[model samples]
Target: MPVVLSLNVARKTIPVDYARAGATGIDKRPVDGPLRVSPTEAKGTAGSGVAGDSIGDWTVHGGEYQAVYGYAREDLDWWQSELDVPLSNGQFGENLTTQGIDHTTALVGEHWRIGSALLEVTGPRIPCRTFAEFLGQRGWVKRFTQQARPGAYFRVLEEGLIGPGDEISVVHRPGHDVTVELCFRALTTEAALLPRLLAAGDSVPPEVVELVHKRSVVELDS
Candidate 1:
């Protein structure tokens, strides 16, 4: 079972006042950093990326040790040692930082328990131009899209307070036959496979599953 060994939220919101931000429509953004947590129920915005009321909740796949999100993994000095770019911190804007989990293989509808906090798997990370502004790179959105390992965004099935060093684990993984990556693609491109993916028709998120149905080129008998 994957579980979180540690979690974190901004000790203080970092500053990201890009000088060219106005030109890019990306300025005065608060960069969340060091969001270590002790594990607790997710309580806050639904789709707004702000975990807690201030931010949002995050979950790991299965219940493996802990889960890791945000730019920490890609930007931290330790991780930077492994990368050529040596990225900066506060890129993920995550409410929770976790360890020991393979989020990519995590299927949708998975539920997790961190300390007393319970979260339900809702969807995948939505890419946009805003993220690219931070990297000063074009196609950053497409790069993430190609990777298809975007972490999961969870909804608070239950609510509670959490701090640093909480044990997080999957409470349940609804026996769905779909992987997180496939879920992402269905929402973006290659939506044609949704029917074959869902197999259950309307069970999956309509925004995702039905998006394909709406665009489906396959002829259906009336």
Candidate 2:
């Protein structure tokens, strides 16, 4: 079973001097004990799980489609060697630092039951300026894009208490080829795969679907 290695949250703090300094909710710290996990009631607000885990910019971050972000411990370990930097849980601002899960191959509509809440994999996290500034890495966005290991975002389906060490398991997987990595590729490197995202339905947020369609139209017209 996949398990949560750490549950993270952060207090809203003063911004530091960086591209993301003005960003409101990028910092997160690991938390222990039981945390509530539930859907966000509005955009830009903390979602149900782990109270006080805030999103700096709700317009772009928190929402039903992006209520909780999960990054695999294996991915973090890989980055540790690549960057030669000390990495820790919540380093990526992910709500759940998970273990024993292949996030790259996670299907967009796959479901996971952790503690009492059920979560649906929504899509791959798109790296942003805030994320880049938080890491303070040079050429960070491009490097991250090239890695193509962006973590997965999830929507809470069932509200419940969750904590570190809770068992995580796939409860359902939509019969579609739209894995998180593939979805990320379709949006970033492989515009030709845009049409394929249509197969994902709600798993791919409607805004993304529209963007893909617009891009596809531009490609055909060009």
Candidate 3:
């Protein structure tokens, strides 16, 4: 059974050279029990869905579709071995560091029941300059994109509280082959996979859907 390994929340923003805001809430720390999960009051203005978790860059980071970020502990362990550096939970700006779950293979629109909250997988976390800078790794964005294990973001469907050690139950899964990894590849390195993302229906992000439509039109014209 999948379980929450750590419940991380950024206590405050810290200065960073990469972010447009000149500060980032990427330095999240694990916290003890009962964190509230809910929709933000406004998109691109308010912060994270998890109460007390700060979002320094509201313009792109926090919104209805990206309310919470989850990263697999297995992935972190892999990175630790690859980089020869010890990594901790929340190191990658994820609010939930999970265990026993393959987040990349999770289907889009899959429903997870954690504690009393219901969260629906919305999309993948796109690697940004901030992420690269945070990790202090050269070519981190390109490397992460190539790896295609870009974790997963979720939208709060039923507000409730979540905590470390809470069991994560997959209450529902969409009937599609569009896993988070596939969507990431389509949006990043493999434009050829864009058409396949349509099978996921409205569960795919609207921006990605628009890109797919435009690509189809271009192909038709050609």
Clashes of each: 33, 8, 0
Order the candidates by TM-score, highest first — what do you get? Answer: 3, 2, 1
**RMSD (Å) per prediction:** 7.5, 2.0, 1.4
Better of 1 and 2 by TM-score: 2
Candidate 3, residues 26-131: lDDT per residue as tens digits? 9999999689999765457678999999988998887788899999999999999988999999999999999999999999999999999999998899999999
lDDT of 1 by residue, 101-194 (tens): 6555666666667656566555566665655655666676787777675666555555454444555677677666676667778766776556
User: What are the TM-scores, per candidate, against the unseen true structure?
Assistant: 0.63, 0.92, 0.95
Tell me how candidate 1 scores on lDDT. 0.47
What is the Cα-based TM-score of model 1?
0.63
lDDT of 2 by residue, 35-98 (tens): 8877775444444244667665566777888888899999999999999998899898888999
Worst 10 residues of 1 by lDDT: 59-68
Q: What's the lDDT for candidate 3?
A: 0.91
Name the candidate, 1 or 3, with the larger lDDT value. 3
lDDT score at residue 73, model 3, on the 0-100 scale: 98
Best lDDT among the predictions, by candidate number:
3
Question: Which candidate, 2 or 3, would have the higher lDDT against the true structure?
Answer: 3
Local distance difference test values of all predictions, in order: 0.47, 0.83, 0.91
lDDT of 2 at 135: 87
